[model samples]
Target: MRAAGAQRGRVKRARLADVDPSLIRPALAGLVPYEPGKPVEEVQRELGLERVVKLASNEGPYGPFPAALEAIERATLELNRYPDGGAYRLGQALAERYGVRFEEITVCAGADAIIGYLSLATLGPGDEAVTGWPSFPSYVLDPLKVGGTPVRVPLERGRFDLEAILAAVTPRTKLVFIAAPNNPTGTTNTRAELDAYFAAVPPHVLTVLDQAYFEYVDDPDYPDGIAEYAKAGRRVLVLRTFSKIFGLAGLRVGYGVGSEEVVTAIAKVRRAFDVASVGQEAALASLGDHGEIERRRIANREAMALLTQTIRGAGLDFAGPAVGNFLFVEVGDDAETMHGALLRKGVVVRPLGPFGAPDALRITAGTPEEIDFLSKTLSDVVPAFR
Candidate 1:
């Protein structure tokens, strides 16, 4: 009987190698998994260091709003109960806050979840989702995961080539994602540019404007997609999150405002209790904390300026405007080498090689001391650039 069991195990081991790879969906087969920012705890654990400054992810260093913290505390008692599947109260709050119809609003786990919903709601096999390259990784990955073609238009000098994006549209194109103040690049389109792009977009296609870092932006030229969506009466979705300026990254709450019909379609496939009770309460609390948002915004601007100036002083050119709480600076050395050197110095930053900027690094705008440490660390590690 033991020999027979051993023989069965051997047969299964041999069959594992012979198993058909086609069992997995072909679209997702070649898809590269998204690489998230390095966690602070991970660096500390790996390097056996107690002080690790993680400026890899563009998370705010000031922490979440006090009210949001209190809300989370208040919500702990309700953990046993499942959250409202419909998210009725939070949905209503968002609608009133954004001046959109209550039916036009939908809350989800985050912008990433909403992106996935958009992919499934709009895309099918052979259909395409158009977006700018090096903008947001999920903009491409989400559609590809759902067996849809991703049409990537290369950026124009670290900015979206709106004309090229429009030209890339085809009969199979069901959606287009515009990451305003685009990720990794930090460049944004002006009001005029957005107006022209929206005017020319075909009515058949849905344009999703991802404004995850909207509050961080202070540029007068930047166009507000929410206002555009409200006035244009087009098939548009504006995605915003409490993650960035609100310092609610851990809560994972975000919302989308769109045409009621489109919101309904996306809501159909939304997972039950997608946003947690704690998350919903925290985000709702965050919306009312304008003072915290403004304070963080001001702090971020100061930190971003300091980082950008330091990079420029080092004779490294940033790819675009440092509109977000991060700067994409040309390392002037190998990205991996600088990344490793900085990692050794307990400075965790993100390499832009995965974001198609092989020569650049994305450093988040952290606290003043952290920024000073990074500035000094860069000078020591990449002296040639300095």
Candidate 2:
């Protein structure tokens, strides 16, 4: 039996050697892939638990809009037909809503795809891309994939340090990615700060303002990042997604709006017919359902409030004044341990250890019942750790 096991290991190693070593990018050969949240079915199977509430991905607790569902159903019969390569109708819809020309918009499989395309289009072996640490991993990974150095500026007091990011830019800097109402922390920058940062950025470097959670923001002071900065003639690309607020994450639709020149350049790097027909139709339909979208925003606000109150009741420290559909809580213990415990209890939340916050967990706002389950699970598990 021992001899058989050793022979099997040798055969596996030999198979690995047969792979074309050059086909793999040197930078990505050993790099770990992004670890997404565990699927609900997988958790149920692993833990032998029937009831699982997942508040990990910052997805809409209220599912997709009714109109979007109807549109998707309508498009199902046309699956054999190819999606519009230009995404003309979706572009027109976004342009009409934002008061921009259709030529200035480009749709992608998701916002992450746009980020990768932008990095490939602008960044190179000797270039540098600047962004804040603990914002989003893609901002760093995309640049690195293109052989560009990722210059990370530490956030100040849990917020993006605009001045520091501006100071980090040099002749080698090719791109900048700023997440408005940043992920994991759920904080946003003010208009004054953005104005100052925009003014300081050189015209040669492209700036990407990510507004994935923009619709959930109710704060008047939360800088209208795209509308304000892009209109001011800055070389900025504004990225928005249907995945979050519209509840079309499964469909994978996102769009980028910017100057015609910037959009055109990024479009060159996009794969052919990348955006699917159903994704385009769903996003278009979602735009017409203003009432439903507003209700989702209200639901998110109430859920966040409940989460905040629960966190305080548990005697935990949490970052708030969030404009997004999630809150970051400091568990004051190893986040991985808490995440594991919650998983065992049929509740799943994101651990922020990968984002450099080992003591924090990013909790998405879910339905009231789901949120209650999360709170109760945490209440039971936290004290034991203490």
Candidate 3:
């Protein structure tokens, strides 16, 4: 048996060695892979539980809008045909909505793809991409994929330190990613703060504003991203997603709005048929259903409020002033322990260790019952960790 196991191991190693070494980028080899949230069925099977509340990923509490569903169903018959590679109709809709020219918009499989494409298009070996630490990992990994350096400025008091970000910029800085209402922490930069930061940044550097959770933001202080910067013709690419608010996470549709030149450059690196026909149709239909989207927004706000109250009542410290669909709770020292404990109970929340936030877990605002389950789970597990 020992001899047979040794031979099998040797064969595996030999097979791996036969693969092209150059195919795997050196930087990627050292990097840890992105850990996705546990799928509902997988968690259910693992825990042997009937109900599993997943408050990870910050997906919409409400599922896809009715209009989007109808559009998707209508487009399903046309699956045999290729998608509009240019995404012309979606681009036109987005352009009209944002008051930008059709040439200034670029749609992709998701915002994540757009980030990768942008990094590949604009960054090189010697270039640097500056962003806040504990922001989205894609902001750093995308840049590093193309041999670019990532300079991460740590957040100040759970918020992005605009001044520190400005100070970190140098001649080699090619790109800057500003995740307003940043992921993990769910804190946002105000319009005034952004204006000041933009003033400090040199014209040569491009800023990618990731507004995946923009629709959920109710703060008057939160910057109206496209209008505040992109419309002014600054070196900014504003990214929006149907994945979050539109409940199209399964569809993988997101868009970037920027200057015609910037959009054109990014488009050069994008793959053919980047977004599917169904996704385009769904997103386009979603655009027309303003009332339904608003209803979801209202529901999310109520859920957030309930969660916030529950967290505070439990004496847990959480990051607030969040303009997004999720909240970040500082679960003292044993965040990982709590995460595991909750997972076993069939309550999946995102641990923030990847985003450099070791003591926090990002919880998406779910339905009332789901929030109740999370609250009960935390109340039970948190004290044991303490």
Q: What's the TM-score of every candidate structure?
A: 0.92, 0.94, 0.94
> What TM-score would candidate 2 get against the native?
0.94
Candidate 2 regions off by >4 Å? 1-17
Instruction: Give the clashing residue pairs of candidate 1, or none.
Output: none
lDDT of 1 by residue, 57-151 (tens): 88889777899889999999999999988788899998888788889998999888999998998889899999998877888888989999989
Q: Which ranges in model 3 have alpha carbons more than 4 Å from their true place?
A: 1-17, 20-23
**What's the best-to-worst order under lDDT?**
3, 2, 1
Worst 10 residues of 2 by lDDT: 8-17
**CA shift at 123, candidate 3, in angstroms?**
0.6
Residue by residue across 1-386, what tens digits does model 3's lDDT show?
A: 35544542343224433667898878777687788998988888767889899999999977788988899999999999999999999999999998989999999999999999999999989799999988899998888889999999999988889899989999999899999889988898888999998777899899999998888888888887799898876789999999998999999999999888878888899998999999999999999788987888898889989988878877788887777888898986788888899999888999988888888888898999999998888788877765
| Error of model 3, residue 133, in angstroms | 1.0
Task: Give lDDT tens digits, candidate 2, residues 254-370.
Answer: 999898987888889899898999999999999888898888888888988898887777777877577798888888667788889989999899998667677899889889999
lDDT of every model, 2 decimals? 0.85, 0.86, 0.89
